[model samples]
Target: MQITKLELHTSCLQQQRKFYHEVLELPIVEENQNSFTVKTGTTALVFSQAPNTSSNPFYHFAFNIPHNQFAAAKAWLASRTMVINTNGKEDYHFEAWNAHAFYFLDPQQNIVEFIARHNLSNESNAPFSSESILSVSEIGLPVRSVSTTCEYLKQNLSINTWQSYEDVFAAMGDENGLFILNYIERPWIPIAATPGIFPTTISLVGDFTEFTLEDAMYKIVPTAK
Candidate 1:
């Protein structure tokens, strides 16, 4: 599956626009007084201004970078801002997934990750930059029950757990894209310490028929083609 678009709420719209358009160097495809959209490879990430009463909304998401550009991409990001450190490490290697990743926080305190999955031949000869980002690879969905969400996905979308599964955590979908279902209030996997669950919307494409899932805090719409 491929994430075509992701909609998020932010209390700081202008700061987010600057961070993504100027700091991250992503092009703003659409903008207005209330929101802005940035082109991130195959995904269009949209951030709308939240209501005054809304809490400081945040989420966790990952970008798929070229397999061979991990170091360059990390350096590129580190040059602009501090790379998040967890357990005294600035990067991570998922041996089972054959991937390496590093994280940083945006102005909205979102745990943004740049990951390179060596299992895929998405290597590039061009220099590493924001353009090297392939797409939004993963989205963390904070649900009350991981098994319930995973089961719903399995029965409806026919997607199974990619690699890991537990009562509190389950990764659905495959390497190209995944829905990381975490138990509510579970801290995201990063130094951000942000809660996993939030009000989020994701629009994606896949091989199966179109479908939609809605809950109190999350919504997923998939377009089949």
Candidate 2:
């Protein structure tokens, strides 16, 4: 599945606009006083300013990059901002998954990642830029029950877990797009932040069907040709 758009909340909109537009160099597609949308390659990230009474829970998400541009992408990011290191390692290679990734934090302290799935055929010789970003492919969804959430997604959306441990974590969907479901209080990898459930909405492409995971209440809207 391809994530066409994702709507998330943030406590500070101005800072987010600067981080995404100036630092990441993602073009703004739309903007208003309360919210704005930026183009992350094929995906549109919409950030809404949260209310004062609400807690703006941070998130973890990944962007797909051309496998061939992994090194260049890392260098490009490092030159612009600090690349996060986990256990003194900045880059990570998952041999079983045939993927390489690096992480960083956004203005909202959200864990952001650029993941290259070598198993896929995405390759490029051109210099890596914001254009090299394929899409917002993975989103961390904190749930109370990993198994129940995975089962709901499998039955309702026809998506299965790509990787998981019964009570801990589950990566659902294919390499192109995934929902990282984890039990609350579990710390996100490469960082020490505890996972928390927040309002989120995702739009998927290829099949025009939509559903919402009641437990997490994440709306999944699909679009088709």
Best by lDDT: 2
How would you encode candidate 1's per-residue C-alpha lDDT over 74-99 as one tens digit per residue? 99998999899878998899998899
Task: Go through the candidates in order and give the C-alpha RMSD of each one to the true structure.
Answer: 1.9, 1.6
lDDT of 2 by residue, 8-113 (tens): 9999889999989999899999999999999998889999998752586689999999998889999999888889987789998988789999999988889999
Q: Could you tell me which residue pairs clash in candidate 1?
A: none
Q: Candidate 2 regions off by >4 Å?
A: 206-209, 214-216
TM-scores vs. true structure, each candidate = 0.93, 0.94
Clashes within 3 Å, all models in order: 0, 0
Error of 2 at 173 (Å): 1.0
Alpha carbon lDDT at 69, candidate 1 = 92
